[model samples]
Target: MRKIFFSGAVLTASLLLGACSSTDSPAPAPSARASHNAADATFAQQMIPHHQQALEMAKMVPSRSSNPKVVDLASRIDRAQDPEIRQMQGWLSAWGVAATSHSMPGGHEMSGDHSMTGMMSDADMKSLDAAKGPEFDRAWLEMMIKHHQGAVEMAKTELAQGADAGAKALAQRIIDAQQAEIAEMQGLLKQG
Candidate 1:
């Protein structure tokens, strides 16, 4: 009887220990385990090149425009967009998706399903590039206003459809920031 009791007690203790050990590590938090979906991937992929184009347009400003406001705006655009481009690229890398090229075979801009609105055509870009001084300033402001509007539109779509919290947050930030920039550009246009 003593032997049987001792064996039963040991078995009970062992089972309890096994159960406790199995639950030692709690399940991951829901937010920590949150996964991205296709909309998030698409937003990141499309926005990367869109930002690169903005940066390109910004780079042209210091060389072409003399207005202090235009120069400052261009610098701000460069600062804001370069990091965003990298962030989106990182998302694409993590998602295991290839970044889409902005160019096509005929040197035309690739819009990636034509969802990329406000994109400057090669001819439009050439026209902007050829303008100097006040002309460049006006053209840059107008183009950037349109570009920012497109960005806001894209961001709104992401916020509506994207699954990742981080991506959705970024989309909201983009909307707020670009909308402010759009207003500023419009003010600048009105001044000229």
Candidate 2:
């Protein structure tokens, strides 16, 4: 009788311990994967402005050049990045965050070169605007390579510290794909 009672207590304790462990598992990891909290909300917000700026640069290519290569490259950039903007917007909606708020993103005003990658400054935009023929193509390639490099850096930062898996996955993809594009742009510049 004593042996059976002792064994029953042990079995009950084991079941209770198992239940406690399973409940705790749901809290930390699942919170990290889907949906938004502060980290994911901030990521999409900051990334929207960043992506919008890149789109502007990509859109400028066709009118600025007659070079088929430059035109093709510009089109590719536009096609790739425009959807990112929309996707990020969707993320913001799903996360219950406002895409545009009265305040600036990541808690600061996002002006100047340091805030974004491959972002064309006022003078850079002017230069591209005025450039024509081979000059236009060369300038576009050089500037875009620098731009893509900037994006690669930003993506790396997101992968390191970002919380949401979806956002992290997208960032990793950008880093891989943009690095390849940067290499291609470098090759084109060298050939020029």
Candidate 3:
């Protein structure tokens, strides 16, 4: 009777511990994932393609732009935005949301046609692509300035509406960085 009672006590303790451990293991992950809302999802979905367009524009600078400053700006935009694109994509994946298409019928990445603020039209991209030397430099700067403005607008929207802490933090960073870049680009434009 003593042996049986001791074994039963040990089994009960083991079962309780196992139950607690199993329940606790999955708790934090779902809560973390649940913290995001529809606004957060929208920001990620829209911004991914927006960032992709900026990358496409940035890629044009090396061969077409004669200004060293413009080339450097393009390089910086590429470096900063690529990781952000990936980060946003990761967020979408973690949230179990699919990202919006990066390409549409018009050769632009944005889905909403001209409604997405500051996105270059297909014509605008073609014009920029056709330009070279100083013309290319000026066009790239102007277009990039507009692109950054659009990103700033989206980030502002995210900050206002997003529930996820990480997304809000990223939005703040985007506003700061892009505003500084906008100032720099404006100065460059004035220089030209």
The candidate that wins on TM-score is 3
Clashing pairs in 3: none
Clashes in candidate 1: how many? 0
Stretches of candidate 3 above 4 Å error? 1-32, 101-108
* Per-residue lDDT over 1-192 for candidate 3, one digit per residue giving the tens place of the 0 to 100 score: 999999999999999888778845454655547989999999988888888899999999999888899889889999999999999989988888877645567544564446787788878988998999988888888888998999999999999999999999999999999999999999999999
Q: Per-residue lDDT for 1-192 in model 2, tens only?
A: 999999999999999888767855444544422555565666677667666766777787777776777677778878888888799888887766788643544443364445455566767877887888779888888888887787777778777777778888888888887888888878777877
Q: Candidate 1: which stretches are off by over 4 Å? A: 1-34, 101-115
Residue-level error in angstroms, candidate 1, position 48 = 0.6
lDDT of 2: 0.74
Question: Per-residue alpha-carbon lDDT of model 1 for 5-117, expressed as tens digits?
Answer: 99999999999888767856864456422468888888887787778788889999998998998899899989988988888877777667766645566433473345477
Clashes of 2: 1
Determine which window of 10 residues in candidate 1 has minimal summed lDDT. Answer: 106-115
TM-score of 1: 0.79
Model 3: lDDT to the true structure:
0.87
The TM-score of candidate 3 is 0.81
Taking all chains together, each candidate's TM-score versus the true structure is 0.79, 0.73, 0.81
